[model samples]
Target: MTAEKEPHLSVARTATSPSAVQVVDLFCGVGGLTRGLEDSGINVVAGLDSDADCEYAYSVNNDARFVHANLLETSSDEIESMWSAGAVRVLVGCAPCQPYSKYSRGTSKEDPSAPVLRFAKYVDDLRPAVVSMENVPAVSRHPAFNGFLETLASAGYHISWETLPASGFGVPQTRKRLVLMASRLAPIALPASNVAKAKTVRQAIGRLVPISAGEANKVDPTHRASALSAVNLERIRNSRPGGTWRDWPDDLRAACHKGESGATFPAVYGRMEWDVPAPTVTTQFFGYGNGRFGHPVQDRAISLREGALLQTFPQDYKFEKAETLRSFALVGRHIGNAVPVALAKQIGNAINSHLEKYI
Candidate 1:
């Protein structure tokens, strides 16, 4: 049966035989998870998301067909239609996680669990052979997660989860993520952490051509940093690796830093250490004042390309075409908000190994 109510997709994933497992990724922003899973030889067939702007990057970077639609509007029947007749099904997603992030704790006005609840419905309707999900560490604690557990239990799926750091999976940042896997085929588990092999800032972006504040690198598009004011330039000039605004001259300090609360958020206006993994990359990572985003020795903030590299994206990964107008705010959101490609690949590796056991 053809998809009538399904969100129209321009391209379809290559049809696979029933012996092969296919994946449909939900909330595929710029195709990070999809790309990583495909790299693991998992044959991700399609990805769906609400943002149409993601279409260009998502389609350009990955083989999966992009479906521009919200998960809330999607039905399980429509999802099942993407696969060949009687194909082994897998559902994977890293839902909108801002509401469950530690930074937005107690401040999320939206129902943070809406996506989780939606995901549960799809699992029940489709009853795929395997399921996978990743999100901020806090998601494991939310009430919605409990509801998700109940749904899986009712469906007779075995589950495993852990709050693992991104560095543990070779990402060049210390981002803690909650990864969960469930399967009706057999008990499954995420791969073991590899923290001892963690990549560092120097290892991730040390070889890229250096560009000053406001200057775009001639060789690469994402290698552009936001322009720094004269004051902020001097602020970074005086900043040391791992040092905060406290290292700046008192004359250059913001008013908020003079109060007793000065001790709070000491990481703000800080520079990253070259020898260590970066602090968690955030939505505002391109701005010098946003967390520890300043380059260790440079008198500028880390550039868009640097942030993406720190997130374990390939150096040539096309976020936007080089000719397009790439703003720091716009591109930064895509890089920082994505699942670090390295971490996603680790999850994919686990899924592949699990599938092989039953294959």
Candidate 2:
């Protein structure tokens, strides 16, 4: 779809003032990173993304200009124009990571280096004071990633990187991602995880108004649940929380499961446990067959809002307008792809703390 630009807020422009720590988020999908930075009291001047679908969410949720431009096409001059000349500049880039995701290992052979290379090019061109990027854990092992680090180090940036579990950062999901931070100002480090006891699935969505399979909560469209077939519902009814499809009776088992290869993939057709953090939320989290997305007690897969909440998005974070379609596939992808707001907030706080040392 052709990307449409969202309306601009005057306050978003004010962030470019000389005194604020101005940030320009690259590939800023739906403003999850921007919102987290804002929560940490940073001044984000703008966000840029090629996806037209992200415009409304980014603009509505954070005080940042949403530029509907692809990173590959946007020039250093164009990005520089968005910030003041004297402000402490930071660039946040979390490139799309499917190429490096664990699930993509065997089936997908895509290289997926374009976005990473584009981000590195932007850093080389802009030479922002601070740079932050997050991706799948596998990215840390890639040769290109090592090359990117070398480039940053050559530019005199004190870099720190680590792979952290989202549960450790208070996200009610077990997602793990590689995070890297580099700063020319001084040595900077990633924030230590805060979730002493990881938040549980029940804690994240216990109070939302319940919805049955295929039912939409009239009060909140995002709370709509995906429908289940009669047989699927019966399977879920028999399945135990945290148990795999192996819990199913022989009659309800998939034909594939009865086959020789079925034992290899056991996470599917499972229900989330109430007391533990959920499995990593994926692009198809609304489907029961996708990961362990079924609700602890509810007879349906978790709702769209539930999925968002699990990703640590604020309860009121806006994704689309009330009149929007709120399609399961679209919303599901948006929620799943987002970097957890809480984890991003920790990154922001770490950067802010590091900056404080120099300021």
Candidate 3:
């Protein structure tokens, strides 16, 4: 593996022309990373994912085509064909992190390494001028990550990676991610946190008018909150910011919380503090019992639109249209799983700076 150097400012701050770059995002859930890359002036040609449902949001919000193919089933030629003849092919992805994420239990029987290894093999075959990946920090400890490292080094690419806190960049959540960048053109490294002060949850979603549980704002369908049962409603009423289930009257606490094992899971069923960054947006951020997702003042979990905002997705960024109904699980999954747009923009800017100097 290539020895990693400390991150430094890119050699040049100027961005190359957008036509000179072509990016293909693999396993793109709903185009979060691609949106940010486009905002940073990179041209994302298309996003490939196994979920056909992502077509609407990915294409509508990004103006990028969506390819419905399993990453494992895709070929190097298929992806390479999307590239412009003389442009810098920038390949990027965040493989599913279920195997390595501390937040999830197993969901699929497929080999966890299959996607990462396949992506690494693509980099080897195409030898794209630039490559980028983002995933839960735990992925760095997995053997698949090591294999990815070896593939890049053997391919003569200069590689660097770092554990970055999304809040430090611009996102208003405390999600930490493992980000890796590789380049055949130059030795590239991630930039330092450019924002002077971390943005808080209030700053991200405070302006939206409050809604009760089971209510959807008349103006924005995505601003709807999931309904809570009577008992769960009282439980949320009792909870405080960053508080655990222990505050609930014994009757309101779940049976799971009565045992000794409950001590280890204190981060759940709590409201977010308004002053600090919100807890990491998860796939179930709409559920009151899931993590510290409850709104600090509102007696309900954060809404889908709020979750997207906390992830730094633009306010006007569309997640659903006339054809797409409001489904929390579906839209929440897209918002939660998406890379924070601000963070991706930072990465894209760094790469553009590298290209300006080297190419």
Candidate 4:
């Protein structure tokens, strides 16, 4: 985190009419954080991201402006301009977590220009009243994350951070993430998980009309599965819920599975158990062999809508692009990359509660 000079602007001069809390979601992909905060009664002014593919989904699904601008190129002054004059300004973001993902172990390090570092620029320049960020757990160990916290601390921000399991907050998926919250107004912290038992795969998507492999639901196109090869189709049919490739018959087992090294990847080519929360939904979740994404009873990988539901997006949540192509590759990435709405809502609730004292 390099030192960047704060923009020479008076808060009073730039202030506009205030109603409640106003937020600017940086690196806001498809407006997941915006939607969750909005559901908690916060006013989100806009979403800023570099991907044009996200424009329609962000604008259509949430009542906020979606600006397709790269964060590294966009200055903090331009960003602070979106803040409401009188409202409590909240800056929230979830930088792309690929750099810090466990899967990147052997891969080359993330580029220096990754969004994770760029978002810190806004924090240094604007110094909003409240800030929230979410990222992969691996990030907490990175020097960049430590530098980010140091920047916040030096700026007089009080911060609280935790590695939380999304399932603890009723996300219906065993997705774990690092959530950080900071405030200049007063001391703030995340709320305790209110959900006692984790939501199950069946509880989340049982109501949806079931579909088979390579078929699309007539009512909702997003409720569609990817076409599987004949061999993969047979593999899935022979697979039992919660069981792995170990269950496959000798003839059906892949050559890799017979090797000693195959034991290392036990979760692959497995079906999710109906009574348990799903494994973390990833960008390739639409593929049957990607993690344990297979439908518990249905002989297919979970549908796009089911994947989104596991992420806790609303049933009617609009993905403008899904209407036409219904391309599994495209829609899967959209749904998988999203933050769980339920978990985000809880974070919003914590922020709202933390601010009530100053309000």
Report the C-alpha lDDT of model 4 over 156-195, residue by residue, as the tens digit: 9999999999989889988899999999988898857999
- Cα RMSD (Å) between model 1 and the true structure? 3.4
lDDT of 2 by residue, 1-359 (tens): 11444454222244435556888898888877888888888888888888878887787777777888867777888888887767888999788787778754245454577788778888888889899998889988777788788889888889999999989988988889899999988889898988789999989999898789999877777888899999999989988899988988889999989888987878788899999899898878899987788998889898889999998899887777778756788888788888889998999999899888876
Sorted on lDDT, best first, the list reads 3, 1, 2, 4
Residue ranges of candidate 4 with Cα displaced over 4 Å: 1-19, 103-113, 321-323
**Index of the highest-TM-score prediction:** 1
C-alpha root-mean-square deviation, candidate 4? 5.6
**What are the lDDT scores of the predictions, listed in order?**
0.84, 0.84, 0.86, 0.82
Q: What digit string (tens of lDDT, one per residue) describes model 3 on residues 267-359?
A: 788999998999899888999888899999999999989999999988877788734665898898888889999999998898899888888
The alpha-carbon lDDT assigned to residue 37 of candidate 2 equals: 86
Q: What TM-score do all the candidates reach, one by one?
A: 0.94, 0.94, 0.93, 0.92
Q: 148-171 in candidate 1: lDDT tens per residue? A: 989998999999988888888889
Backbone clashes in model 4, listed as residue pairs? 16-85
Instruction: List where candidate 2 sits over 4 angstroms from the true fold.
Output: 1-19, 105-111
Better of 1 and 3 by TM-score: 1
